[model samples]
Target: MPLTSVEKDLDALTMTITADFPVPVRRLWDAYVDPRQIERFWGPPEWPATFTRHDVFEGGESHYYMTGPDGERAGGLWLFDAVDEGRSFTVRDGFAREDGTLNTDLPLTVMTFGFEETDGGSRLVTVATFPSLEALEQLVEMGMEEGTKAAMGQIDAVLDDLRSFAAELPVAAQLIGDTQVRVSRVIRGSVDQVWRAHHEPELMKQWLKGPDGWIMTVAEQAPEVGGRFRQEWTREDGSDGFGFEGELLESEPPHREVTTESMIGMPGDPARNELTLTPVEGGTLLTLVITYPSAEMRETVLATGMTDGMETSYARLEDVLV
Candidate 1:
């Protein structure tokens, strides 16, 4: 209930997972960082792991892919946080599209993974905090505990693979795209829930992805042409990065809403983030059209985080909607 061994839930509503492994915290911590060591044990029964890449660090990322024991493949980001050497680190856990592309429709999750040292071995505790109650229940029903166990098992296997696989690969330089990211996702929640999920500041924080210090400044709803729907994204760490700022191009409240321009770090005047909604699946299909005014602007924004960061965000969104 508390999600850890320390507390219990009187409400009996929340879902939290705690597990121990036959290893030391130091060894476990090492396994988490060395992406090469992660691919071995990340999938469930009959689901084998497939590695396209693994990069883990502060501000760095890794991706662990699973080819189902049935030969199905899924990829997501391995972003870390709260990393204490020899102790444990947390991963944001981002999701990727089928062909290993970022699903812009999803926001990253703020999942906390820890490796604590014990006398016998190490105790690993993974707490995936959901943004809402619906999110928490959905994850539990979706077999989050069993799934995590499988993924952790994969982590163990990854450590084994590190022995045979090449350990060192040069990191790739930041690359932005000439192709704009046009993305859409269908969320499975009532219109009110989806509207509340996006329009509420507290709800936004649970899924918004970025480096530390990433915060949303606004989430107001005004249904008018000249009306403004402004949101400023900030970083906890003092990096002058661009965030979102937009004006309500059009709005129909719970039915549909659109923004003309939304930019990162700077005002939406130069850059734009457009959000459109259509009723679908008894919920809504959220589509985003983000336009970076200049090539440099696009590249600069994309340069800040790893691809997994986006994946983890999407997974969180999936967690909430389901």
Candidate 2:
């Protein structure tokens, strides 16, 4: 009843209409067969309903009725050829008269329904095969394409909401690369001044909180190119905080310092943030290079989430330096 897609083949003037839905193929098939559920949005729900027969099995006959203010009647029937539970099926749809007799004006159609997972999501693909492309062209001239698009648009929105209700944890990561969010602020403080803040227990409490369940037992640093340091942020509730210790890549007192944290001892998975401090214009320019080992890893240190925390640390650093 709802068309999701219509891919055109202009070379042969052929088109394939598809509706990839989140619903199981069997559920979607049931809606096609059940007149009651079909009434919700089938064609138009504003029309009045007339008592009709609904037979939704392979060999059952279906008869339904609709009446308008102007005494109009519209109904259809489908003979299901196969019903596969939760998979796919085929059906033949045709129009019928008010008295349940077949209408010759309606063309019988063979619709193939498919259920699959597309890009980690469920999709129901339906394709109606016509007798020939000429019939398809004739329907195109009758504006079938436009109507189908409108119907499928509604169907897609419904399906999208349905899928959202299912609730999958969306993966979080920077849409752009990690370097994109990193900011470098040059300060006039010497490396010893920065290094002192890095190791101060009071300073640690002011900024970097350790893993959610862990506390920083120590904040130590070895000021050398190959030196290693360990810092921990602790929660009084005995929960963990985000903290790690990594080797220093480069170091020059009052000049530049680079360090890395594998984040093995933190609340989240492993990632590296390279912090650089350089002397510039009688001050030190601090460049932070946050290397997310993976997209998910990178999101753990988003600028938005870390803004307040980082600012707190910077303020504390200023206090200690001044």
Candidate 3:
């Protein structure tokens, strides 16, 4: 068991758990920041987790759910309060409803996770502060301690498997619930460079073209929140053209951006696209979570070889960065 100790303070209304791992601090930190790795052990053995969204910066949020053996699911949310890179981070944790909103009836907690180097490897200290003694008691009665221990017990295997979430992997998309999908890729560039590549009109025109023989004719980036942006592409022969336009909803420079995207001339609700860039070991991990109008719309979009096209464009982006 990786858990070294678990302490509860009735007066402080806090529960602190300490665990030791046989890896460097960076490796352990990456395991938590990367959704692909974190989901492996974020839930108990029987209730495996699936993270639909994970943004680690301050003011960000994460949405995840654990699926029980019998297909029952319990949702959770994390509102990031502070982040100190690999050292420590804090979040307001609470239960979430099926619609991805917070369950107000459940008590929320403030959890801080601190990491540091140890003689053998590294240590993780998590302190969860409840709103009140009653909240702490309620959680304990729900087997919080036992479920946490069971969850942490599976981390060793994830840390040892280095090839799974490596930077060399191609663009991959995973379905989230009924109307959402998470697309992930690692660009061989810094977070700033990757973010610029997506925003700067000149740079975007250079590498955003999906496959060969197509050229980007228009690249208009939204300068700020509530601004509109558009991009259009055409084949070299000036045939089979398409475009997309939308308004920027949220912007956190070099880290995250949220926008609405819809095909030009298509009369339908626009999809919500949330983009997050995080610096990982080999490069910057780019995660784009798209929420469509319906499951059918999500399927129709993905069935158009979107992932392959994205892979091609990202590969070109790496070359452009070089």
Candidate 4:
């Protein structure tokens, strides 16, 4: 086991767990910050996790759930209190309801995760402070200690698999839940540059074209919360034309944005898209989480070769950045 020790202080209402990994501190840190990597080991063996939203910055929030073997699901939430880049982070952790809201009936804890380099690898020290002694006892009784150890035990495999999350890889999409998908890519540009490329009309017109034969005809940015944005594309031969428009619900500028998207001429409910940008080792890690109206809609969208088209656009984006 990678776990070095587990300590509990009833007097202080805190529990600390230390684990060592056979990788550099940066590698270890990225595994936790990236939703694509963390979801692989965040839950115990029997209860695999799916993160619908994971934002590692301060004031950010993450919502995830673990599915049991029999299809039972338990949800969780984390409110980031502080972030020190690759070194450490603090969060308010608590149970979440099915609607992704905090479950006030359950106990909440303030957890701090500290990362440091050791002789050959790195170490992670997690300290969780309970609000009361009863809360501490409640969580321990619910198998939090054993469950955490089981979760950490699976991290070694993820850490050793480096190529899967490398910067050179193309765009990849993972199903988060029945109605959500998380699309991830490491764009070959700084975070600010990438954000600008996405928001600026001229820059977007240059690289947001999905495939070789398609051209972006319109790129109207939302610019601010409550604003509306529209994008249209046409085939080279002027036959197939399509467009999408959305209202910006939230904007965090160079870090995060939330928008509602709908096909310009098509019918149905709009999709909620949450985009986040983070600086990583090689470039900017861009994550787009989309929530569809239903599972059928989600599957229909993915079946249209969406990921391949996204990969093509991102490859073009790299050249535009250069």
Candidate 5:
């Protein structure tokens, strides 16, 4: 499932949901930022939502109602506290009357949405903060957790429509070894530019990301065969993030390079990464081969998704190259 985990912290009075999408961060962000798009996937399939009013700026108010299969209606309001375009946003959510008036008698919560670009795709972290542990537990008992998951599960369909409308091409991948898969892209830059984008820490920071809001806060690298590199990325608030480190197994400038990458505080062993750059007619052909320690690992990675991240990263690389 796209929804990976749902964690509720009693002491902190917060419930957070982690979900990954095999779509560009910009496209996923639009699912929330665009009112027309928001209504499409804002509720479970059985209880679709309709927005009567939506304004996403700071202090703006959005009013919507979800209609159940049985014709029951649940109205809600989102009082925007802050909005960071394409990266994150904070809102005060609560029940509302059909006329868009806040229902003070009902439960209210503060919600924050954070988006990050990961190696596989875009990771969306959503946190709902309640007034107290009691309030949180009460919502959980009301099936808020399950409802939210069901609602988010529909995001893939929304993204699929957007993808079709944009007519974007998917990245191509091929099985090159028993435990390896090769993903390739034609980058619109010279071999030197493509090589720098992959080898130089500064250049790498510009395009090696899944979504739009995140920045490579720390990028340190050494190009020698025995040298090591580290890259850390985080949101502006630093509430959720991760870093990875690796050692260069082979370093041939502008042509080939290899490394073993291991994530901090993550399961599974390190994976081997090999990159090849070939000069092409109008640009450079960049190919990346990832070798897993086991066939199961490789299959798992493919099953989870990787094309969106690769396509987004390449698109960003083209922007940087231009």
Candidate 6:
């Protein structure tokens, strides 16, 4: 999270600010396009902005107001003249009245925001052109430069908050005939975080155990396509233990994974496991489906209270994520 560099050029009657954000271009673009997200970081550090109307397309209009420390309201407007999704946009920014109308007596600046993908993440460049040097000086005197920089500084935290919302506990188990058992839950984090928790051995060891007394000592994973993994579970006394080995048939980071799981103690056949992560409103919906060779095999596992074990394990997983 580098500080934005603000450059004021009175000779050109323009001001430009450039900053690098350690997030994807889409995330950076959303700061300018999405009203809900924009409101979180659209003003100075202390003076927060609230949007009343926001339409982020070409020829659209946005109306918002920033609240001062003493409860003073400063209304502003953005009239979009051009828009290129995830790329660039140009808008006219000016003072507005509280009733959602522009105040012609105030100065206006035409601002263009450009987003570009960088080696690390994304770079955002904003250029504001004023009608004259007097207007530019007026804006600078009004603390626009410092206010805009402070607003941009909040982007990193806002993006993190957007990804780390509350989780929803899904139905522990749904038995679909004899062929499948679905275990699903919504984790309160990004798709990448959830995926890494499942794919990486260190994160997996945090929550992949069954009962209270059992400990997962070994978690070896090769998380690429055609890779293999093994998980070993042991009791506190080291008297009772079992393990499962699996091969990844399909692997898609932050999305889906298909694998074949074979338990060491199981007498019958191996199970095909499919884990899918879908991006929902607040977090990721992780759906784990276990398919058996036959209905009898599924019934046998269900009768062993596998659903209860999964429910307990997933409940413990909440702690790991938070």
For lDDT, the strongest prediction is 3
The candidate maximizing TM-score is: 4
Q: Candidates sorted by TM-score, descending order?
A: 4, 3, 6, 5, 1, 2
**TM-scores for the candidates:** 0.43, 0.40, 0.95, 0.96, 0.51, 0.52
Tens digit per residue, CA lDDT, model 4, 1-322: 7899999999999999999988999999989989998989999999998888888899898889999999999999999999999899999999999888999999999999999999979999999999999999999999999999999999999999999999999999888777999899999999899999998899999999998999999999886799999999999888889999999999887789999999998898999999999878888899999999999999999999999999999999999999
Off by over 4 Å in 1: 1-15, 104-107, 153-322
Give the per-residue Cα lDDT of candidate 4 at 126.
100
- Winner on lDDT between 5 and 6 is 5
Error of 5 at 37 (Å): 1.7
lDDT of 6 by residue, 20-86 (tens): 9888887667555544467788888788886654555576667778888998889999998998866
Candidate 2, backbone clash total? 20
Please state the error at residue 318 of candidate 2 in Å: 72
Ranking by lDDT: 3, 4, 5, 6, 1, 2
Better of 2 and 6 by TM-score: 6
Model 5: residues with Cα > 4 Å off, grouped in runs: 163-322
Model 1 scores a TM of 0.43
**Which lDDT values do the candidates have, in the order given?**
0.53, 0.52, 0.94, 0.93, 0.78, 0.77
Tens digit per residue, CA lDDT, model 2, 246-307: 88775544333456666654554444454444332334445454556676555655744665
Candidate 2 lDDT at 56 equals 35
lDDT of 6: 0.77
* Regions more than 4 Å wrong, model 2: 1-4, 8-15, 22-34, 44-51, 65-71, 156-322
> How far out, in Å, is residue 230 in model 5?
61
Tens digits of per-residue lDDT, candidate 3, 1-322, equal 7899999999999999999998999999999999888999999999999998889999989999999999999999999999999899999999999888999999999999999999989999999999999999999999899999999999999999988888899999988778999999989999989999998898998999998999999999887899999999999899999999999999988899999999999999999999999888878999999999999999999999999999999999999998
Show pairs that collide, candidate 6.
none
